[model samples]
Target: MRVWAHDRWPFPLPPRHTYPQSKYGLLRERLIAEGVCGPGDFIEAEPVRWSELIKVHDVALMGRIRRGQLSVREQRGLGLPWSPQLVERARRSASGTVQAAYAAFQVGVAMNLGGGTHHAGRDFARGYCLFNDVALATSRLREARLAQRVLVVDCDVHQGDGTAQLLRPDPHAFTLSVHGARNYPFKRIPSDLDVDLPRATSDTEYCAALESALATALTRDGYDIAFYLAGADPWEGDRLGTLGLTKAGLRRRDALVLDALRGAGLPVCVVLAGGYAPNIADTVDINAATAIEVAVRRTSIDRGGPDAKLALEPRDAA
Candidate 1:
């Protein structure tokens, strides 16, 4: 599977900042080291053009971001200090999802090593997110006539408030978010479908809720592609997450979502949404596991396996 990464372009962060900026690079290295993906499978993402961003974001907001003119309140809401490199990084990160969405059409699955910036709304940035990557990808795909119907499966511990706000009103898009009920973005925007698991929810309960949610979300069969925000923060070890899912359980969560999407015959674009494990390595481990799952599925499809045949069969694209 092809993976998009932008960690080579580093952005500055405050000393001892809570955000795990290192995990992106670590994940890329580990995936190559473990042979889950070859170095050639990794592609360096370019910064998304401002014209493409304006299709989904407000013009004023884009101007402020580009000119480094964000007010103190806006900066506070963004959670990251304004810098040229920061703006460049956000553009590159958003570009990765757009690139991955296009790549998924060729391969059964593709991945963006860093993304899932679902908290940035049309005119606002919040919760460490500066741009709604999935929304941008959706818009780009529609403009190109590659996909009219899109599904966003956001499993981050935090609600995808920005994504819900931007895409929920579109008749052709389905936004389904399974997140901690009491987590960040206390004033949540509703997705098309939301399954809010309680704090300290166990893996079994989490999977059960997710499986049911997937069943409901996949009932309609015309989605051209699905974007999966396979967040690692739900792990018990994560500082920012309140769930009780173990590493094994998170793997199960990935399988449940991937299998359902594959069964629905929708190509998958996987992204590393959020992971704040106290140990950075743990976050890397979880993200790597998600990549491994995508790789395994791609291999299955490439070898003319049952999954390949299932994927090739025509689906109702109404």
Candidate 2:
């Protein structure tokens, strides 16, 4: 398996500032220590150009950010205390996803230790997401003609409102969001396919829903590539996630997506979506486990080992 990672410390971070909406660094740190990924596997991508960002974000709104002219209304809507560190952190997080996508396209699977900020909208940003990396990557792939059809599998507990909204008019990319029906972003923008589950949903029901969704996305839609937002927020211990999924349940969710992608002959690029645990360490651990699962599954397939391995194989017709 040619497992790889993207360098995500793209923005300069600050020392003291902290908030629930701004603490995503732990996801990157844990991936390194747990052998889920290493410095050797990581590739530093050039920061996404303004042209690439402008493809989805409004020029006027982006200009204000570039000028560091943050407003009270914008900051509050973004769910952060306005500071250079916070601003830089959010910006780099989005860029990391685009970098990960480029990496994964060349290999088979790659991950961005930080990204999956799916809630930022064009002409606006929100919900700890200054920019929507998932949307940005999808847009780039489409504009560059790298993919004809793209599938975005967002399993974050909260809806990917921004992603759904941004691509609602664009038909080339299909957005599938499986989230807690009662969670934040109470209002939703329609997605190509949305499976909204009730709060406190258990393992069996969640898995069944996820598997059915994955099968439909890969088989029915005929997407050539996919972006999987394996959010840690779905874990039962998460403070923000409304649904209660045990660690095992979360693993099953990841496996279902991975296997489905392989069965459909599509490559998947993973992004660490959302995780807000009362204990930050718990959130980091959750993301690390998913990363390990993807890596191991990738390895087993390359070696053609015994257990079910989620690796892409070209379709016979192709």
Candidate 3:
């Protein structure tokens, strides 16, 4: 499996900001240390083509961002100071997901170490997200005719409001977000399916909800591809996350999603989304478990191993 990472290139962030920009680089290091990937497996993502970006984003907003001309209000909405480097980072980060989509088609699975920017809408940025990478990638794959239908499973603590709105016009795209009921983006937009959990929701409750959501999606015609937004923020230690999922619970969650998708013979592109544990290491470990889960499942598929038996099972949601 190929892992796309753009954290090697440093981007400027506002001083005193609590956004763990360092987690990107740390995730890469931990992946290597844990043998989830070797140095060669990590590919640097190039900046996305403007043509591909404009498929889901607005041209005027893109121009303003590149020119660093966004008003103070707009910049605050992005949660970052506007700089050329920041712009480059956003472009490259989005590109990583686009690349991962193509890679997933070639391989059984692929991953983006710094993507899952689901909060950026077609015309606006929010919650530290400058661009909606997964949305743009879904559009690109559809335009290329690489996939007939796409599924987005966003498990971030905050709702994928921007992605839900951006892809709302496309019937071929389905978005599902299971997030905190009361978190960032208080005004949540609807997804194709949303399983909102109350604060302090445990792993069993979270996994049970996920199983039901996947089953409902499977009731329709199957999708050609699935984008799994493996967010790490649902951990109990996360300062920003209100739920109470443990690290073991997070790993099981990843396995449930990845195994089910792969068992259904759908190529899955994994994206590391939101994660904000009080101790950054905890967040990194959770992200590591996600990547390793994908890698292991992909390897099993490659060896013609037994398919996981959890793909379409029906279960009651907690």
Candidate 4:
């Protein structure tokens, strides 16, 4: 399996924020150590081009961000204090998702160590998201004929409102978001397939709903590719998550998601969405476990060899 990552790309999260040592990072390290991927498996990802940003993002807004010129109001809007490094981190995160999609095209699955910035919008940014990678990646894939029908499965605790709004009228893509009924992005947009779960939903029920939704996307909707935003905040210990799933339950959650795609012979690109726990290590560990689960399953099927790499992904960066 091919997994995409870059060292020193995150925004240098605060120690107490619980986003710094996120499990997705650990999962990447764990997957490498566990033989899911050799050292050579990871390839450096290219940053997204300005033209790609123009495809779905606002031109003036893009121009402002490109110059590291966030207005005083804009700074407060995204919450994090602005910096060039933050800009670089956001760009890399966006491109990482694209690279992961390309990697999945080469293999049955690819993991993006950081991405799924779905809260970003065409003309604005919010909730730590500076750009909408899902929209950018999907556009690149469709433009390259890598996928005729793309399905975005966003399972983050917060709804992929930005992605949903951007792709709402796009016929080539299908946006499916399963999130907490009352969470971030209080005003939710309508996704092509929206499933809002109640607070404190059990693991069994959550997995059941996930399976059904994925099944419908792969089998009935007939998507050529799938982009999964596997957020770790669904865990019970998450500082911001309202769901009540345990760590093991979260693993089973990944199983249900990956199993659906693998069973349908669909290639998938997975991203780290969000996870804010009281402990930064736990948050990081949680994200890592989710990634481990996806890689473990992907590597198993991928051992069948190169034919398993037929999943198409976007190749063009510009």
Q: What residue runs in model 1 are displaced by over 4 Å at the alpha carbon?
A: 299-318
**Root-mean-square deviation of Cα positions for candidate 3 versus the true structure, in angstroms:** 7.2
Single out the weakest 10-residue window by summed lDDT for candidate 4: 307-316
Query: Judged by lDDT against the true structure, how good is candidate 4?
Result: 0.76
lDDT of each residue in 28-139, candidate 4, tens digit only: 6666777766666665566678888899899998888878787888876777766777777777778878867765766667788788888888888878888998888888
Report the error of model 4 at residue 154, Å.
Answer: 0.8
lDDT of each: 0.86, 0.71, 0.81, 0.76
Better of 1 and 3 by lDDT: 1
Instruction: Give me candidate 1's TM-score against the actual structure.
Output: 0.93
Best by lDDT: 1
The order by descending TM-score is: 1, 3, 4, 2
* Order by lDDT, highest first: 1, 3, 4, 2
RMSD for all candidates, in order, please.
5.3, 6.4, 7.2, 3.3
- Report backbone clashes per prediction: 0, 0, 0, 10
Clashes of 1: 0
**What would the TM-scores of all predictions be?**
0.93, 0.84, 0.92, 0.88
Error of 2 at 220 (Å): 3.2
Model 2 per-residue lDDT tens digits across residues 1-318:
233333444343345423344344555556667755553545433345566678789988777766677577886677655555555555555666765565556556667767788888897777777778888877766766777678899999999998888876677788899999989788788888999999899989999999888777766657767899988888887878889899888888888887777567777788887888887787777777777767865523432333112222210110
Per-residue CA lDDT of model 1 for 1-318, tens digit only, reads 557888988889999898899998898889889988777666666688888888899999999999999999999988888899988888888888887777687777878988899999999988889899999989888887889999999999999999999999989999999998878889998999998989899989999999999999888768999999999999988999888899999999998999999888888989889999989999999999998888887633433333333222221110
Query: In model 3, which runs have C-alpha deviations exceeding 4 angstroms?
Result: 299-318
